[model samples]
Target: MAKDHGPTVKDDKLYEDLLRDGASKGKAARIANAKAAGTLDHRSSELEDRSKADLLKEAREIGVAGRSKMDKAALVKAIRMG
Candidate 1:
């Protein structure tokens, strides 16, 4: 069973599952909270469909390193890994 992560973690089970799947603590928490808030179903645009400028903007928002130097494909990969 998953340990309770207290009130701040809205979905402890999902958070534990995400941790087991190698997601970082922050990432898992964000996803868990989003799921609990019923907002996870709203998908963002696919990386492949976005222009380089759009990808760069997202990369910047997410604080991807060296985003200014990354190409579209690289940005996509980085965002996924991030």
Candidate 2:
């Protein structure tokens, strides 16, 4: 059977915060906040110039592991981080 790895320290805390507010948030929100706070790899400013397709290609080139599954916005985020 596959193992169930629990949430990381950071994710756990963020989830808790969402719960406290009675607003269930998705992974994107957590990722965005982390990025904004300079904790995640990508900064919002860096992705401004690229088109979505270009961003996805760049993300793949930069070795974002799940590039195939990522959408344009997510690709932008990952590329910036990478």
Candidate 3:
């Protein structure tokens, strides 16, 4: 059984699995929480169609730095990479 990582971690099992698969701490937590919330998405291709403001919002949500100066393409890349 998976041990609880704390209240901040909504899906402990998924978190551990992601860790085992070499995901970064922040990345694992984000994925685990999103999975628990049923918001985890694998739609990288659709990012291109999103506006820069939308991508920047997502970047802010994921704690991406240097977002304000990033162009649309850069924002999309940053958001996708997050």
Candidate 4:
């Protein structure tokens, strides 16, 4: 008989906890990391590599405060430091 093989995976609760704390591009990256670790869904990985402007746009969508007045670099920093 053939042996069964299963996919590798990571903890899902950690990712969810981070997300519940805040909604931002940083959270998106956490989700991406979980996906890479085979835990969360692989949807935001591309977002992890996006440019500052693009990241800011995504952060805006996630409803980061003061985003509309922030510059691209500031947005990236806020998102990453959140």
Candidate 1 vs candidate 3: which has greater lDDT? 3
Please say which candidate is ahead in lDDT: 1 or 4. 1
lDDT of 3 by residue, 1-82 (tens): 9999999999999999989988887888998999899987655548888777778877888999999999999988776566
What TM-score goes with each of the models?
Answer: 0.63, 0.38, 0.66, 0.40
lDDT of 4 by residue, 1-82 (tens): 3122123213344444555667553564555455556755333555445676677766765568988788767776776665
Model 1: what TM-score? Answer: 0.63
Clashes of each: 0, 2, 0, 0
Model 2: per-residue Cα lDDT over 5-65, one tens digit each = 2543245555555456654344434553564467664324457665677677556655679
TM-score ranking, high to low: 3, 1, 4, 2
The alpha-carbon RMSD values of the candidates against the true structure, listed in the order shown, are 3.2, 9.3, 2.9, 9.6
Worst 10 residues of 1 by lDDT: 39-48
Candidate 3 wrongly placed segments (more than 4 Å): 45-54, 72-82
Q: How much is 68 displaced in model 4, in angstroms?
A: 1.0
